[model samples]
Target: MNTLSIVIPALNEASNLPAVMGTVPVAELAAAGWRTEVVVVDNASTDDTAAVAHALGARVVHQPERGYGNAYLAGFDVATGDVIATGDADCTYPFDALPDLLRTLVDQDVEFMTTDRLHRTNRRAMKASHFVANHALSALSRTLFRNGLRDSQSGMWIFRRYIWDGLDVRSAGMAFSQEIKNAATTAGYRFMEVPIEYRTRGGEVKLNALPDGMANLRQLFNHRFRRQGGRGEAGIPAQKQRSERYEAV
Candidate 1:
């Protein structure tokens, strides 16, 4: 049976995890031939993040190295599935969209899919400054990497595990979001974007808008100018590489 690993990076989402976990359509996912496994990365939280996830029947991995990228990289290292889906633990990204997101990946024959929250249902979902910063980062990505992405800062993404073999993911901070997309697009991975509804998160917002924005901007320029010699690829032919073997961490 095909496995689908849902990776959720949580800081202190004890209250919010139930809502997110409850929305996962297990029956539908099973009917569609995916055995669901939810992996929650506890990113060094003071609250009961790990306990809540364990009580809810999720495999919790404690990541002492605290960063958005570090949490996700830890999750990605341990996810045992053909396809991996990532989202925020704060409940900003919709859990109900997983079914469509998976279907779109199969139908379109794409390796990577990310949500576009530009046409969001909740107007107050994102601050005006954040919205502007996101757009600026997206524009920078398009200019540097030439991928027509509308939302570069989106935390939600789904893709085949093997795609990591051809792409380099080196960021250990918030800039990792942009780095993954840039590497994927630069390596010519098939990409698609799904329009998703954005909502206000239940937990305390972790994003430092100005600092994170500046870091992402610098990452964009650096990636465009840098020449990665041999570490870019997985050091093997794409067809020769094992589909299940992932070495991102």
Candidate 2:
């Protein structure tokens, strides 16, 4: 079976960990020919978050930095799966949808997948902030990267290892989402977006759209000039992560 590394970027997600863990239908994912491993990226959390995750058989990693993408990059450095899965730890995205998400990645033959939370099935269930930010980011992505994005900032994404070729990414915050989307357009890599429901965070929300929105807009222009002008080198294949040993899920 091809391994799947499910990375959840969390900050003080202690109370919600058990709930999120329960959302993953283990049998469904296992039956899909995936050996699942969950990696929790802790962003300097000040709680028993690590202990709780370890107790539930999840591998926990801490990043010295404090930001969504920073935690993601830290987890990326440790993943060993051929395909990497990233979703927020705030219990907004349903982990039970893993089967569907993974299926789209393979059936579509794409290296990148982003989920649209406002898609008919989930829009009725989403918070206003989520609906607005997704719309804003998606529009901005289309303008800058020309990727025809419907949910550019969605934390729910699955990426094949090989798509890293011809891409150089350096954003350390929420900007990582736009950076990847922009690179995909420039590199001409295949990407697909499917719809999923969005629920409110089980705890305090870690995001502020206005400021993050500005950052995202800034990234779009930066990427446009950098790609259209003679700036970045062609993408290179992503290297295999050093941690080959299985960490408990």
Give residue 218's error in model 1 in angstroms. 0.7
lDDT tens readout by residue for model 1, 76-131:
77888899998888878887778888998998999998878876565589888888
Number of the top lDDT candidate: 1
Task: Pick the TM-score winner.
Answer: 1
What TM-score would candidate 1 get against the native?
0.91
Tens-digit lDDT string for candidate 2 (147-212)? 787877777888886665445666778988777766765677788888787876788877776898
Tell me how far candidate 1 lies from the true structure as C-alpha RMSD in angstroms.
Answer: 4.0
Give the worst 10-residue stretch by lDDT in candidate 1: 240-249
Off by over 4 Å in 2: 124-126, 227-249
Scored against the true structure, residue 115 in model 1 reaches a CA lDDT of: 77
